[model samples]
Target: MSSTTRILLGLALGAAAGLILAWFDPAHAARAVQFAQPIGRLWLNALQMTVVPLVLALVIIGVSAANDAAASGRTARRALVVFALLLSAGAAFAAIVAPLALSLLPRDPALIDSLRDAIPAQAAPAAVGFADWFTAIIPTNAIAAAAQSAMLPLVVFALFFGFALTRIDATRRERMVEFFQAIADTMIVIVQWVLWAAPLGVFALVLAVCASAGASVLSALGWYIALLCAMYLAVTLLLYPVAVVFGGTRLRRFAAAILPAQVVAASTQSSLASLPAMVESARDRLGQPRAVAALVLPMAVSLFRITSPMQYIGAASFVAWIYGIEVPAAQLAAAAALAVVVSLGSVGLPGQVSFMATTMPVTAAMGLPVAPLGLLLAVDTIPDVFATVGNVSADLTASSVVARAEGSSEPAAPA
Candidate 1:
């Protein structure tokens, strides 16, 4: 079976075991939760340890890549600017939509009990006023921030470091990029190694949760899948209008051109893998100039993922809902900006890796607990289909926008 299936099977079998134990003997169910909690915690720690360094490296690389594009020419610069604005808009959009969507769903008290029961209790976080948050944006000490795991400030340092690399001599800049690239590649391998143990980790985690609250966790999880799928589909449909209005492309023709690429994206769940289909659609169906399509599509795949912000913000919002935290507008705004930055930095990551790597920071930024994320990751395979589709749709739309910006005069192909 595939890795996703293995982890999901682990989730299923765990729920079954936990439910049976809970049904047969409440005493034993409590014991099972106690037994499984430590193992699951260890796995979560393993996933989190990689986040700091991986994000540092990724932010540097992502920023430097965009800077390089900005230097290439006017067209490339415009595309980069457009990509940044679009990513920010998606992040802000999710901040609003996810909370509203969760409000409409039934809140399960047992689900909260299950999460709180599965993990050990901690001291509540102190409230930080707006002044405190604004001051924390630029890290006074980068090393201190990393040690404290202050992701938002540490991310700020990384962003500055990335731009700094662009100003130095070319040879030195090349060396730094190479060095960070090696670190990123090495961390990816480590994360892959950690996830290879995911089935066991998921089993332990879900067993504890289900043992504590039986099947109520299932209801909350169902809400997540449905909500996220709807978010992605909404984003996908949202892009068609963007292509028509901003891109100045015919609506029917744009829709028809992007359909095949969306299909490939849904099946593969990889934008890099879907590149050829996007190029083909852009060149053959949209009638964008070959040069514009070629340049913009690849760049979009690397730097722009419309759903990354949505996923990050959505995961954080779901966690907040589970814990009954009323996320202040201040915190949600911080989370939105954090989501856009981290998502840009970590584009094109594997699903499992991105789920942990990108989502943890936003969760932490919003002051939500990260413990429930392991359970959420197990079910991401379902919504990832729609996430990829949304991404492909955005990629094609971006190409159309860039083509228009470049003043491509090629006559449109038939829908």
Candidate 2:
């Protein structure tokens, strides 16, 4: 069987096994989940270990080999515009649709109260200002940023370092580009080795999640969970047609291409972990040029999180609907704007923490209770899988669109 098929099978079997265990023996299942957590973490660490070096090398080589600074800047601007539009659409859809869908669901105050009680309180960080957001992108210490997996700062440093090569002697520049290319090629090999364990890793990860959270946790927040899943599914489904119609990608081709990356994203719940798969898929399956894949995918991972706006806006809207808070049109607009800014700014943070930090201010702005966030976080795991899939799909779609626009109609020869 193909690796993608194996990964899918692992997901199904692991979830089934976990659910059965949870149904039969909650205590033992919890213990099993505890044991599996470390295995899953180890797998995730193995993937993350490649992210810094891989991303840095990709950015450096892509920039250094660009046709010209002006052309590269135009490509970057086009990518950003596409990213912003997609984010806005997601946020708007969630803001408009979630509240209406949530209203139709049967309200259960008792269940909501119980869920809130079960979740421990977490203090939200102070809101990030525009200055702090922009400043954080530039690394004060590149080494420290890499060590911490600070993606935005590391990307910024890589861009500067890559551009600096263009100003040097031609021979030296070519040598440096070749060196980074070698590093990138090496990291891609390491990523492939890591992904060979994907089925096992995905199984462990999914098993841990299902065993620990169980059906009971989901039962308590059924409506909320259902709404988020529905929204994520809708957005994910919509992306395909958009890619096909506008980006000239075939649906089957796109789906098959992105499957491995989507699976990794679903299992690991970290787009950074799935970056290698995305880059590979874009180059090999989607037929994007090397420069476009390298340039677009890394930047997309760092800046263009399409799911963030949807998730944050959906969570906030759900909270408002549950509490009978009337968020005016103006407030919803403000929330959408905030969602875009936060989604763009919260690069490199853990998915959940970033969601909370970015959404908290919008919640406060809309006059909704912040306590419900803990409950949202509690049930966010399953929904996160779909969200990650959406993000990875968008990464590939964006790459294809950008590549086509840049006139790289044919895929570059694989490195």
**lDDT, candidates in the order shown:** 0.87, 0.70
Query: Once superposed on the true structure, which residue ranges of model 1 sit more than 4 Å away at CA?
Result: 121-127
**Candidate 1 structure quality by residue, lDDT tens digits, 40-117:** 999999989988898889899988888888887887887887788888878888999999999888887876766787
* Residue 156, model 1, lDDT: 93
Taking all chains together, the TM-score of candidate 2 against the true structure is: 0.58
Q: Backbone collision count in every prediction?
A: 0, 0
List of clashing residue pairs for candidate 1: none
TM-score of 1: 0.96
**Model 2, position 383: C-alpha lDDT score:** 79
Q: Write the per-residue lDDT of candidate 2 for residues 55-118, one digit (tens) a residue.
A: 6776676565343433667777778778878889889888888878877866656434433332
RMSD of 2: 11.1
